[model samples]
Target: MEHPILFISIILEKLGLPVPHGFVGNGLLEQLCAPYMTYTWLVMVFLFVVSKMTLGNLEMVPGGGQNFWEILIGGLDDFFVENMGREMADALFPMLTTFALYIAVGNLIGLIPGFMSPTSNLNTTLALTIIVWVTHHVIGFRAHGFNYYKHFIGPMWWLIPLMLPIELISNVARLLSLSIRLFGNIMAKETLLGILFMLAGAFFAPLPIMMLGVLVSLVQAMVFVLLAVVYCAQAQEHAH
Candidate 1:
């Protein structure tokens, strides 16, 4: 039997609906999965559409889409400011917001039947974690210059040997933890949803499971964003 989401996409295509699609090929699949391309395409299209819609016309009275974007962006800005302070938040807002949105969208894309969340893939999560790791250090360096390394050093001169390696290991662990946390949660959600759907078939039994998957995706995205903010905040932290 055909998958429900694939079947729906097929029906929509037959009806001439313009659902975003990728050119399926093993060459593309060898390096990058179809969902990764789909997610990337969606993000590009989202940016283009938003730019065209809001551009210079953003005014006292905003359109629905602009208003929604404002609410999302504004809320995130406020949250980051509260955690990281105004100056740091201002510097990182664009990157943070972009990552959050991309991840949220990537997670949700899996619910569309044929598409799986690119975040479920370890490669995608590792790449995201590395970006966050680098950005956090950049913020740290700008905030404290060479003294940023001082943060990794122990409180005392003698402890530098002990503390530096420990700190280095801990930092390396963040890369693993961030990537694993994201990849594991997303993969688990998809696995559970697939199993539930297979067992329950078209019945309402799997409906709740589907909703659970959506909740998992959202919570995981928020967790990932919150952790990123915390990491950035730590990197910029001064005064011990």
Candidate 2:
């Protein structure tokens, strides 16, 4: 079945706005802008609204929406500090948290009856991978100048001949791997659930798969966030 959200996302592109176009539309700018809509922008809007609504009022003890959001951000902040150090954590926390939340929401969006999870589309995932790749490598080169190339070449002059191509291939593979893994898993899960829903009219029968859907959603989010953390760390790594 053709996903309706994918179509709507395409129509948004037709108006010259940015939206993802996997199988929906075909335009250079549409392709370029699609990821922003499919994942990043959508996620950002959700996060912003949720955060503002949740934490609109600061409280000494916290309750309800404020408490929930505080716990979420606080937990994420702690994770970042443990992984990336206090200063870096403080600096990158917002971006990292935003990325995670976006991917998570994008993944789960498919679970809704009419909407499709944009992350399940290969183009969407690839676009996100490219964004991360560019951002981190740019930061690395900016910080370390020519030394950032060493990440691809490895340590020791002797290893360059053998390791350069290997490392280069690995880096490229990261994009493909990240994109495919997310696209395949989410798409497959949704497909299976879709089939089961069609086959079984009983509500409880599909509940298990829906539960799995939630798991896949969280896992995909974690994978994206984890990769982002690794990229950020590598970009900011001490130069050899």
Candidate 3:
């Protein structure tokens, strides 16, 4: 199938940069300008600008942007604290917040015309999953030192033979689960919207689906973060 031309691709092509006319090819330049990568960069820039605008000015009263950000951040902080005690929450808050914001924005960006969701790509989702997986394991090691390995061993010594492999397999499976779940949902959402747009032809018929897409995007982001929090919290727990 021919790839839909994105506004970014047009701009890049006009600027004399190489951009493949159809689907992303194997070339380095094509991969760099792939729809998902381009939109991902756009989402990152959008978030950066919004963050600066929201956080640049400080006021005693805290109206407008300050009030909005405080409420959002405070709510997220409280949610994390409730899930995993204060210390762990404090340690993981920034990373978790970044995950939530980035995933949420990336997922939602697909609903906009000429944009694609970064989370819809397996590479992007896998990258995020790997980061989360490594982070929790590192936290586990920090929290429990070498004893973190005890987590893989069962309560009794003999059970270690069976339990160790089981634990290892399950942990590894998390990598696949996290990445595939997000990628599948967002990709399906994007596909459905594309079909709807083709059928409806710029009409309001897709509005309902778009609204549901928003809910799906938020729910998926929350689900991903919630699972990450659970994994991190479990890692910090003392081994039986």
Candidate 4:
């Protein structure tokens, strides 16, 4: 539990706050989201309330805090709409926004001294990828009915026998790619920063690299959201 990111966990562990069997006394690795999960949940709730306050308002003009959230939502809306089209973007807005908020927050939290990004864990990223993967296909089915599999069956009927397994494998590979990409990037940044802090100096030498880690964190979050938008756009092609 002594890895640099688990500063909060060390305190909780010391207080005997109950570890789940195997997590007991693991120095290098602890549960992925035990202490951080509660913080992540609270952050989500805060964002939800902010969304309601801004979006649910009848006011034609936004106030200060409302304006901040509006800009974020509006900018992200435009980003997705540019890629996915207005109709599909509008339809998938809630899911896209939720993904952006959670992943962005999760990634950025890793920059905090005592906190770990859940996105750094393969299981968490895989769960999210699976959700988006299943969701888009479900939307595809709803939009295209049985015709949805047409995307997988290849553009030519004669190619089904040759293309089917290839298509299926590629589809499944998306799960791995999405999860591994997020986990690998975040974990690399986290581990690199820890090493820099240790080897560089006892103090200020790691600051510049840590600042770059902030940029890396935000970019990773954006890349995840952007990919999700692309997948949704591809799936809901019927609406166009």
What TM-score does prediction 1 earn?
Answer: 0.81
TM-score: model 3 vs. ground truth? 0.93
lDDT of 3 at 138: 96
What TM-score number comes out for model 4? 0.83
What does the lDDT read for residue 177 in candidate 1? 97
lDDT for 152 (candidate 3): 94
Residue 21, candidate 2: C-alpha displacement in angstroms: 11
Which ten-residue region of model 1 has the weakest summed lDDT?
A: 23-32
* Pairs that clash in candidate 4: 1-27
Candidate 3: how many backbone clashes? 0
lDDT of each: 0.79, 0.76, 0.90, 0.77
Across 1-240, the per-residue lDDT of candidate 2 in tens digits comes to 533444446566577685643444467766656543445466667778888887787889888887777778888888887776797778777777877877888889878765667787776788878887787777788778987787877778899999899988988888888788888999898788777777783766678888999998999889888887787777888756
What lDDT is reached at residue 115 by model 4?
71
- Those runs of model 4 whose alpha carbons end farther than 4 Å from true positions after fitting are 5-7, 20-33, 45-63, 238-240
In model 4, what is the error at residue 209, expressed in angstroms? 2.3
Ranking by TM-score: 3, 4, 1, 2
State the lDDT of candidate 3 residue by residue for 218-239, as single tens digits.
Answer: 9999999999999999999998
- Report the poorest 10 consecutive residues by lDDT, candidate 4: 19-28
Could you report the Cα RMSD, in angstroms, for every candidate shown?
Answer: 4.7, 4.1, 1.7, 4.0
- Model 4, span 166-224: residue lDDT tens: 98898889888988998899889877777777776477766887788888888878898
